[model samples]
Target: MRIVEVYQSVQGEGLLTGTACVFVRASGCNLRCWFCDTPYASWRPEGVDLTIDEVVAKVEEWDCQHVVLTGGEPMLFSELIPLTQQLANRERHITIETAGTLYLPVACDLMSISPKLSSSAPALASNPHWHRRHQRERCRMDVIQRLVREYVYQLKFVVDRPADCQEIEEYLAALEDIDRERILLMPQGTHPDELADRTGWLAPYCQIKGYRFCPRKQFEWYGTVRGS
Candidate 1:
């Protein structure tokens, strides 16, 4: 597998946020969001090469029962099937973090899909609409369809302002059939204080709307530590 980095950290996002997890950050991504956190994996090649077995051994060292296979969109790797299957065979619980930009044919325990919202414009005024319109129809919906077919996938959105929630609602409404408990809204930030500040806005939004609110626990506790 083409791995960018692997380490132990609190799960900073999703349904299992705050839990101890072994993070397998794989390389490469399909989209370049305006506020991307891990540009090194998205735009740069910076991971050590490791075979499937080597990768598995590394997970064992984190000494955690739970593991997160994330990315520059972790679904970019085809070997994820063998990797997750091998890990699960050992009774280790696993989560797959993705953009839902591609169909996930493999069955993992949890799928935390953060669909890029319209507010992350690409400088061009029409980019957000074009992306939300075509990108969702072409990739994201197919992901949702496939995910619902086999695994539990959550719809996690990152919002910065009230306007962002408009686009988020548009996307969520399209997935009206999804179980409400599986949806989450989080604020975008690199630090815990930032998330803490925006949580006041987003947390109430979720509570009132009956959707889930996800806090970035890694940041809450360690503020993006490398190996905490």
Candidate 2:
């Protein structure tokens, strides 16, 4: 598999925010979001190749119980099956961060599914290839539905504006048995100041909708640097 960087960092988003964990960020993505923070992993893939055993060995060095298999869509790799199994064998709590556009029968303690909304679509002028490809592959409702039903999950949506809230609501309404509490609405920003600016309205929106408001605590604690 194409391995980006493996490191120890506090879980920055979702229900386990602030929890110490090891992150295995896989390079390459099926869809490109306009605001992807880890462009090295997606916009222009970068990383060395590592076998499943080597990846597992790296995670073991952290001395942490929690592991996050994130991406540029980590689900894109087949090595995930063995990777998750190896972590489970060690009793490490596994969290798979995915775009929820694809699925693999990998084991996970928490399936962190971040479904892209219309707001995530890039403009036609901004690299037409990715713009078209991102929109085309962004949402796979069948995949999202199956993931939520099969795994201990959380549905995280990146909200940039109040209008995006309606789209989220509509999405949830269309899905069956989606737990309201499991829904996380995170402000779309990278920098601390940028996050703060959007949190003003987004936090309130989450409150009113009975959804959890997820802050990018990593941005506040570690700034917008690589490896958390």
Candidate 3:
């Protein structure tokens, strides 16, 4: 796998936030969201190359039950199965953070699929190459359907406006196979307050719609400081 950075940190988001965890951030993403906070992992080269055993050893050193395989899009690298296998052997719980752009056929304890809506406006302005690339290559929503169904698989989206909610409903409508209760909505914000500002409104929004609200737990506790 092409690894960007690996470190021991608390789970920063989703259901596992604040849990002691080992993070494996792989290099090279297939998308370019304009507001992406981890551009170091995406647009720039900020990674070191390491063998699978070396990476696994690092996780063992952390000695935690939670191991999060994240990325630039860890799915970009296929050797994740080997690492997951090692973690499984050690009985560590493993979670995969993916953009739902690519399909994964490996085993995982949790599949957190965050599908990027068109309103994400990835490459909306600066990415001269992204617009063409986005159109040329098909973006598949089918991956969300095929995740190891043993886990209901959580769904999240970064939203900045009310229109984004409508988009989520439309997307979910297309995938009638997915249970609506599995989806949670959170507003987009590089910082948590941007998330909190609309929290009052969003909670009711989700309540009225019967969806769940997800706060960016990392930001709620630690503000802008990274890697809690």
Which candidate gets the maximum lDDT versus the true structure? 2
lDDT of 2: 0.91
What digit string (tens of lDDT, one per residue) describes model 2 on residues 121-198?
878885788788888999899999999999999999998888898999888988998999899999999877778889
- Quote model 2's TM-score: 0.98
Computed on alpha carbons, the lDDT of every model, listed in order, comes to 0.76, 0.91, 0.75
Task: Report the C-alpha lDDT of model 3 over 1-228, residue by residue, as the tens digit.
Answer: 778767787776667767888888888888876667678777774788778898888777876888889887888777877778888888988889888777756568888888887765556467668765654432466666666254547787777778778888888877746766767787788565677777768778899988878777766666665455
Could you tell me how far off, in angstroms, the CA of residue 53 lies in candidate 1 after the best superposition? Answer: 1.1
Evaluate model 1: give its lDDT: 0.76
lDDT of 1 by residue, 1-228 (tens): 778788887776778877888889887777766667777776564687788899999999866999888878788788888888899898888888887877646658888888876565444564655455434432476666567557777878888777877787777677646888888888888776677788978899889989888876666677555545
Candidate No. with top TM-score: 2
How do all the candidates rank in terms of TM-score, highest first?
2, 3, 1
Instruction: Give the least accurate 10-residue stretch of model 3, judged by summed lDDT.
Output: 131-140
Candidate 3 residue-wise lDDT at 61: 82
Model 3 ranges off by over 4 Å: 123-125, 135-138, 148-151
Provide the lDDT at 16 for model 3. Answer: 71
